[model samples]
Target chain A: MDRQLDQLLSSAGRPALCQSVLPALLGCIADIARTLRTSHTVALAGTANAFGDDQLNVDVAAEKLVRDALAKCPAVVAASSEEDPAERPVRHSRDAGQTAEEASSEQYTVAFDPLDGSSIIAPNWTVGTIVGIWDGASALRQPPAERQVAAVLGVYGPRTTAIVALRVPGAEAACLEVGIGDQDFRFHVIRSRVRFADPPFATRYFAPANLRAAAESPSYMRLITQYVGKKYTLRYSGGLVPDVVHALAKGHGVYVSPVTAASRAKLRRLYELCPIALVVECAGGRAIDPVDGEEILARPLEGCDDRAGLVCGTTDEVDEVKRELLGASLESCR
Target chain B: MDRQLDQLLSSAGRPALCQSVLPALLGCIADIARTLRTSHTVALAGTANAFGDDQLNVDVAAEKLVRDALAKCPAVVAASSEEDPAERPVRHSRDAGQTAEEASSEQYTVAFDPLDGSSIIAPNWTVGTIVGIWDGASALRQPPAERQVAAVLGVYGPRTTAIVALRVPGAEAACLEVGIGDQDFRFHVIRSRVRFADPPFATRYFAPANLRAAAESPSYMRLITQYVGKKYTLRYSGGLVPDVVHALAKGHGVYVSPVTAASRAKLRRLYELCPIALVVECAGGRAIDPVDGEEILARPLEGCDDRAGLVCGTTDEVDEVKRELLGASLESCR
Candidate 1:
């Protein structure tokens, strides 16, 4: 390796924060993805099944990866999951001047879906990762609605994009884009103005099933049909990577689900499967409970239990769907 | 890029087979897996109720990756799970020696579980690829089982391991082996000498529900206590990658579901997950069909839909389980 390149690689390999799970997961997954692309075998170690269930799912891998990344970091506390039966134990490496509480307290704890859209794997469908957060372990332990930390979802396809929510301080959100096919690539957050500058849906929709529902309403269906009839395409893949990429490229589509009864029905309420709902909302799009049209509560234990309803998209478009569904039938409300 | 490195990369990019739907699936899956590992956004195009009632699993971005890899191959027919209700078209690529007879005649085809264990993506479990052969398009045109020609399951884990089988001119039946994992991975054929290599007890017994019942059998219980006792360790991870890997490493285990009453009562019939069973048999283990104790057939389907029985390390172990189950119940066999 060139001296400069070696230095650069070493720097890249360095842990970014004391609570370094994110960087570690990012590095590990990147290596695995590249190896697989180059037609080589890739492996990951760290977390095993804490729940002791025989079934394999993304939660296991995601938790494992996150925990491994954070293994060296002492600041992160309670990197937890809806799927995990227990809170991850902080087996952090010993460091000087670190109290047990300070070592375990997460300045930032990331909850994630390490690999999403996994059911399609046997047939070779695209999969993705979703990561978001709440205040800390206390907030995470709270029911889903009570926690209020920002989040992000890194959806992978031919390229990978990150929808990041800046939680503290300014508390703004942005979309970070990375092209995997491009050899020398870097991430650039989609500008804030570009994220929320337009009316969410002035035309047809291109969305993943879950997000489409969370972000729109039944009345929007009329608009969607009109838009499609005018040559707009309503495209969606079961894989989150493809779905989010299409939405990102097209501009107006909701990258996540819309909050409306009809829309939620459309999504089949796969809450954790598409954490992009939080990502989309944080990035200036709408995130809501489709049936009630309420803002989505961050870190809500109740809403993300593999059974809660969620929706995301531009605010106005989401409202339209909710209005239409509410007007149509009370049954739709449930 | 270095010329040598570029050449190696290009060669790595080459499609493996000449005439099959596999090239596309392989490339797409490999790319998506790479993208996921690398944390890049991936997108798919052209998906809508194509292969079955559900959307075809392939899309535009995935197709491009597949095409680029297959550009140099000698493929006759290129089938994809993504294309709209159509068999893969035959190519006139010069390398394939396209001729009147060749173009019109039925050609070989491949069926693939391009991405396996994907459901675990959300949970981060081991995922893999499953490829199989079909004499023609018959298996694909109608049902799953009809298309198996030769089959292999490629699992993405700590190491890439390919559990493969071929029904070639081997004097008699199919031969199975672990072709992709371990630095010293070698194909070892099952011979009578090693056939009973292990103890008389089933080496690995999973399917806890069924095993518990088998353990309750008075005769089987006596045998386990007297012979197979403490050494028996029940191991099963819903993820096939680990389960198969563990079984391969450990030698023998029973993974039967007890489908039929007689088979269930006797605890003998575990032939359903053929590839797994084949690997065991090829590795000098015994896979029983419980009901008839016939040579287990790998069902030509998507999942482990067959009734279960016993998988043992040695013939003696299988016989012990069989004798207890069939003691006087042979006439009751289904």
Candidate 2:
């Protein structure tokens, strides 16, 4: 299984940076998946994150696992997590005395949402881990399109699977779907080149996140009505990772999390949005800012807590969302 | 793990019938879960079922596994499945020559949707197996409230879990949530008495299936608007088993599959609706026919192909759905 992942990365022209970082990110994901399956009872941690969201025991544990794994990777100089928003220096055990400046030249940074859907985990629903690997000492103040080298969306569902997107400096960008074996916890390539379904599908699917935003945004509400009228299947799981991964797995679908005045978007750009956008774009889909209707990858990460509304999935469906949600206002401006 | 399940059933006064049937039913479910986790590739069978829904290779395999397992349970005299919607006599190995009439005295019948969410399975999303155990040679022409002795909803998700509801003739009805261990494939009781969350929850959830029906029924449309307007969390997964299971796991949610002129209900009464209704009701929730707003358990199964709209979940939420969807018309009639 590991061989398949190695082959996929090699075919995509693996940079030395990804070679050091991917294993650490994926290893933590595997550990988390195993822990989730075995630990039947997940308790509330009696604490909240910086964002004031309550943390589960599993969430805290997963965040630690990710941090610990990244600390072992010599090339991963800095990392930020959703649970802990501050970007911290990751000092490898082998190079304990290495200064931040000395490591800056060949260093990579990571931003991860260790456990993305903790709200739904108590119910034993499928959650996920999102990791974005940036080719720098830190991910701050840089657009994902320019700095993000690879991203992994690890899905903990009926089967542990991942959508890995690699965009090294020189090679062709690739998105690969791999399944983790229960016994070995190793990833085996499921689909080497994951892409959205060719257009004109018989039944289209949509995952409309933050449906509460509909009450405030008439356009968002109308878009949902249009989708229902068109007989598009609804597939929201209340988890950003699974919802977006659905589009990648099925090869079709749209996932929209709109930010309205009444319902502010909560998905962080550094930990969640950028990683997801990288994977979606790599899969031949589109990921865009819901407000401006621009590619999400083009947005720069201002800080660890940067949040945004996302409209992502099949290219045409995303285009349709932008047109329906922003068309009237844009036309009025014109 | 098995001990926990045995204890749960024993506490509910396990009828000699469930002793033979439960093991067989759950064994098949565990087998299916294992198969689902391991099978990396699932292909289309290139054929459709009696309902004209395309079947996947995994779906076909699951149906056969269920039938084969039931064939070993001497007490399970007959069985029917969604794939093959005809009642067939299940002949045990030791009782190969036993006539259906001879076996009928102590026999139980089984109706199952071996794989409830084949459409979403291709996306590597969580799907499930639903089994309803009836205390008779056949399940036709009897209400689930009287005939359904036990029901099991096997969830194949990030963690393999099952909600087992037992309603034998004499003992108190009980609902249990159990997790299936990956290694041993044994059932471990997670929640012994799975009940809906106590009322007055801060955040309510709703899974509105067949959203297309919203276009045909103004009442259904208004109900959805009310849910969104009231800020109910959307948790639909386009899969019946997981959607309903979410309600059980979260302890507060409603799943509505409304039947209208445009969107006819597809959930089979014998296989899908009855089992789910049993589990929900056992969990102190309510399961009702969406049109009449009556308890779903009271409806008699006319045939294996009988299908109906279901509004089930937290008791109060189910009541709210009925009130919103049927209140105006009822008031007009009054």
Q: DockQ for each candidate?
A: 0.03, 0.51
TM-score of each: 0.44, 0.91
Error of 2 at B10 (Å): 1.8
Candidate 2 lDDT by residue in tens digits, B243-302: 988777666899999888767878788989899999998889999998888898897888
Predicted complex 2: DockQ:
0.51
lDDT of 1 by residue, B83-146 (tens): 2223455353455444443344445454333444332332223455544444554333324223
Candidate 2 off by > 4 Å: A1-4, A43-55, A94-106, A332-334, B1-4, B43-55, B94-106, B328-334
Q: Docking quality tier of candidate 2?
A: medium
User: How big is the positional error of residue B75 in model 2, measured in Å on the Cα after superposition?
Assistant: 1.8
